[model samples]
Target: MRRSGVVRGWRLVALVAAALAIAVVGVLAARAVLDAPALRDFFSRYPGTTERPEAAPYGFPAWLQWQHFLNAFLLVFIVKSGLQIRAKQRPPAFVTRRNTGLITTKRPPRRLGLHVWWHLVVDTLWVLNGVIYFVLLFASGQWLRLVPLTWDVIPNAISAGIQYAAFQWPLHDGWVHYNALQQLFYAATVFLAGPLALVTGLRLSPIFTQRDSWFTRRFTETAARRLHWAIMVYFLAFTVVHVTLVVTTGALRNLNAMYAGRHDESWIGLAIFAVSLVVMVLGWFVARPALLTRLAERGNDVRRMK
Candidate 1:
């Protein structure tokens, strides 16, 4: 017989508990090993962070705070709507594109599920925000802070990873520079994973699929679908680890730098962070099918799929 929902939920909880216990024990064992004389000497030699270029940027700018907030806000909705689209195979309502632009002559009106329409809308906003972020990141010379400038970063990143795994996170001032591990992860998230998601998502989108070409035939829809799902999982995992580290390492200082654009130990950053969380939670609940169908019907023809 198939397992009931309650039984499955309990099983998931037990599985998560077991994983956490294993992780704790593993970290303790690694800590004991790293405390040995040989490893201690290695740690002393490499430390956890390499020296950054003299021209590297410092301090979180006000624009960065706004960008951070917008990115987070859009991401919450994007992920929520994306998951909704994925889970609900037969969308309750469908939306046919409204043709009005000059480009509409090239491509006819296309029909899509209401959930998919929501995902696409949020994703477009996220991409636009990312474009603005990239422009500012380069214009302000903040790219130097995230992209590694030397080969020494490899060893330093490894050292930082060791430190993190051993329950000894590297100490660094975020207002000035991030440790090697943080720098590398940030770079990968921004450049590599972000583009991967965009590319894969586009491959599965109506604009690309509506046309037939060598590229479309080679990159199958099934592959794009699977890769897109994997990218989402990667993003979710990254967010969990990033938030945990931010809170555990230096919650107040980090929050202040990112949210309030200040370097003080005040509680303003925490307050802002709490407010952002509330907004995200409200967005999660407010994005229901009933509300979405009504909103989507304003511009496009929305119909309940019989």
Candidate 2:
């Protein structure tokens, strides 16, 4: 039976609530066990340090601040539209006239055409932003801050994990230093997850299907789709944990660094963050299928003209 939109919405809410409840229970249990003498000894033995080579100055530049904002903005739209596309359950609204010969298994609803269009559009923007970020990061030599240079990072990351489990936050000076765990996570997000997402997305595109090559054979559409979904899950989990730590550990200082490009603990950054958040929320409301369809049609027109 086809469920009403309200019923589906409630189901989503229930699922999210269940997940949060499980997370809370898991955290409490971990905390109860994390402080045991054996575990404490193990953590102390590691005693991780945040040492890095040729570290840049511990301050956010104007460019970095703007990049951060753009990344967050693009990510929000990408994730939202991506989810909408995934939720589709009937045939595509329109099919290409060209015979690309790509398999189409799932029949998505007509409305999903808009979702897919928005997802692709925002994904392109996100990739461009990432490219710019990479160039500037390496050029400025700030990549050292995220990419670990030593094998000790593994053990140190474990120690950092223990600290987090015990509710004792690690020292965080993001402008200057990040704990071993933070460094590893950031490195994975940048060098691994980001590239994997882009590659998997491209693999699903018609452009890849049009060209028969060893690359396409190795990364089949099915594999690409599954990996893309997994990447989305990873991003969602990372965002949740990252935000929780940011707010719980030190909101003011973190906000100051990212938003205001300052080290001081002030409300200015928080205010700016709040305004930015409002804009994002407003965007979320206005990003309807009708608007997306119009945008997608315009894009198609431009492509044909080209």
All candidates' TM-scores?
A: 0.91, 0.79
Give lDDT tens digits, candidate 1, residues 9-59.
Answer: 999999999999999998987787668887887778778787877898888
Q: What would the per-residue lDDT of candidate 2 be over residues 1-306, giving only the tens digit for each residue?
A: 356888999999999999999878867866765667766766666665557576555777888888888888888888887887678744234323222246333432122254565677788889998999999999888788888898988988877786687577766678677789988998999899999999999897666756679999887888999999999999989989988888887899999988999898989989999998998887788886655555666424212211
Q: What CA RMSD would candidate 2 show?
A: 7.0
- Model 1, residue pairs in steric clash: none
Question: Against the hidden true structure, what lDDT does model 2 obtain?
Answer: 0.77
CA lDDT, every prediction?
Answer: 0.87, 0.77
Candidate 1: segments with Cα more than 4 A from true spot: 1-21
- Number of clashes recorded per candidate: 0, 5
- Once fitted onto the true fold, the runs of candidate 2 whose alpha carbons sit more than 4 angstroms away are 1-45, 89-112, 302-306
Residue 202 lDDT in candidate 1: 97
